[model samples]
Target: MMKRPFGIAVAQLGPIQPSDSRASAVARLVEMMREAASLGARMVVFPELALTTFFPRYWMSDEDAIERYFEKSMPSAQTQILFDTSKNLGIGFYLGYAELTTDGHRFNTSILVDQTGKIVGRYRKIHLPGHADHKVGKPFQHLEKKYFEVGNEGFHVWQTMDARIGMCLCNDRRWTETWRVLALQGADIVAVGYNTPSVNIHWPEPPHLRMHSHLISLQAAAYQNTTWIAAAGKAGLEDGCHLFAGSVIVSPAGEILAQTQSEDDEVIYCKADLALADTFRQHIFNYGAHRRPEHYRLITERTGVGDPLGKEPDPS
Candidate 1:
């Protein structure tokens, strides 16, 4: 059966000021949603930590001060406008935020909302990057490992209006296992959001190579998994840290369908035919036909060890 083309959007947001209130943030998001709706986008994706500045960049000893950045509930009085606007415009959106559960667990999380403004799926970031402890001499801090607890919800896909959707945040995009797990669950499209710093502190990476690595990862995952992927980013300089804008939408064939043109607030739209995934899934990359899971046990069993079994594969 041929599927209808659905218009999707990647909303690249500029930096959110440290002093900006959630109401102001949602207003900005609503304005972007209006633009997307005008462009006929049925689904839109926003960036990680969309409501606030990249707060993890600052080291704070006060727990109360750090907790201020997390949302206790989605669509609270401050964010209700985003939900109402999405429902009114009939446009679903994927939004990333800091989630504080009732049990006091904080996570780097993203939620998928349907066109009706209903929360349909949620994903917590699995790959928490950066140092957990405060480094006194670093120029800018990346305290994600210190601020948020490791996400417990494993990668999963959901049946949504346009396709089987999956969600991941930031560093999850760099891990091949992230895509493989989602693809294994039959995800037709994956939504990802990131706020990557232009500078790599641990091991300095060339600025150009950092962006190149990002694009290569997206292309490789899209083609290898045969799934449409939309990646959005919080662009521009936040405080003193710079974030490059490379927001894009990728086709099942690993081609970039649309991308942002600036390092600020921008919206890029593309019509995606999700059914194209079937061609690769049923033929060349069919898991049931070609996947040799028996020979790949090391991927799941090995933990922080290069050669856990101490045995090499026999050359037959």
Candidate 2:
């Protein structure tokens, strides 16, 4: 089944210092969006919290965090230009940001906009990582749990711009269930945005493994779910903290079609064969033919590892 190829891009952002204004950050994004359009990309994926610095690294009161980092509305005065650009260029986009709702709820969120600049779907980050309490001895804090609430809405896929697209943020990409839930809904492409520090604050993890693990996780998810994945990262140093950059566009076969070479603002484009996913999904990942939901009760029933569910079948 041959389908029209779709052009997609990942726009990797450089550091956004604590002092940088939202206007400055959005200008950078507009530049990249135009560049992606020039490259024939119909859609561009931006990094997590692209409008501001990764603020969870600092320990601040909820009031200060909301006032400084979270956006009360998606297309506020500072961000309206992104939507305008999308409409002018006739391109779609996925953007991640810190969201503050009218009901006083905070969430790490992302929105999917179609080519006409209409928001088609919204996804809040489900897998919030890190600790709620501040660690006194650590160099920097990862206080995501303290700042944002766990997303209430579950995973979803929306049909727009001639494709079925899904959205996830940062830590969600590392979990298998994230991809599975989106795949089960027939997502042809998954757009992920992240802000991952080069060093692990909780453990003495080798820095190189950060990039390696990032790539491997995307590759594994793409192949297993038979979906194309576009992941963008806010890279470079921000207020002395380093975030690694390896923004990539991966194919359904788990092959990296394009990757950014620098830890700065960059754009990588790929002409993706939407039907490529069908080749694998129709055979290797034929869920209806191979899945066994009855035997996987442990996945939903338990949160922690314990004794085996039942003894192995007796040989006698």
Candidate 3:
């Protein structure tokens, strides 16, 4: 008998502001979830910082604002409704948020909740960007570094819906190590979500088609790792900045299965096969089987000050 193809959805959310209520956000998710189910998706993935507009820049001096935006727990009363909705629909999801710990360790977090409404696994973002201090010329895109600490939990993978799933937040996909670690863990699909803006004057990448910012990073990661990737985005103009929107899903064979259009909330849908990952794994490109770790001793070496063989010591 031939194996069946699994399915996934890229839920590209539009600009959700500080003014957007939790009920409204949950409603949007409900609609999207139904839409995905209609498209035959077994699973769906939302963008990083999905609950609200990316808030790292505000320097949120008012503690109340911080608590209001940060999710203290998964399925908080407002979010539990989403879990219930997914359970009813029998479609699992991967969600990202600004998580506030009980012990006060805030992090950029992502979690996998099954169709049965069970939390399967969680991951905190290891790569944190933006400055903690307010920049005079740059306006308010400041302070993720000062607010939420870097994620302590390393990269991870989960088994869900007959597929080996993996999760990563914004900025994590920029580093190959993110995909490599999960690939080594035997990942079949990698879920990534972001809320990238149009202008930053900082590390602005060019678009492969219409815009330089989106698509490139996602396609690169999906193709290089030989794993399916579903990338969702919070896009469009929010508080004067235009967030780029190009949510997409790619197959292990480097084919773009689906992609969302610009500046609006949309769902890009496609069927993902759990077994296609074996095509890459069985080939010489398999990282676990063919990785040259012995030659990789050079990455950690300080090129100028230290030698790979540790022949020289730093002058500092």
TM-score, candidate 2, is: 0.96
Instruction: Candidate 2: list runs displaced more than 4 Å.
Output: 307-316
lDDT of 1: 0.89
Q: Clash number for every model? A: 0, 0, 5
Weakest lDDT window of 10 consecutive positions for candidate 2: 307-316
lDDT, residue 141, candidate 3: 71
lDDT of each: 0.89, 0.95, 0.80
lDDT of 1 at 24: 83
**Which residue pairs does candidate 3 place in steric collision?**
6-272, 131-143, 206-212, 207-211, 207-212
By lDDT, the best candidate is: 2
Better of 1 and 2 by lDDT: 2
TM-score for every candidate vs. truth? 0.95, 0.96, 0.90
TM-score of 3: 0.90
Per-residue lDDT tens digits for candidate 2, residues 1-316, read 8776999999999999999999999999999999999999999999999999999999999999999999999899999999999999999999999999999999999999998888999999999998899789899999999999999898999999999999999999999999999999989999999999999987789999989999999999999999999999999999999999999999999999999999999999999999999888898999999999999888776554653544433433
Per-residue CA lDDT of model 1 for 162-252, tens digit only, reads 5899999989999999999999998888999999999998777899999999999999999999899999999888777899899999988
Q: Candidate 3 lDDT, tens digit per residue, 1-316?
A: 2455988998989888777887788788778988988898888898998888777756567375467778888889889887998899899998999888989888888899888878898989888867666667675575677777889989888877887889998788778778878888888888888877666645454433334435666677777777889989888877776678878898877777888876677988887776677776777467766788889766656443446554645533
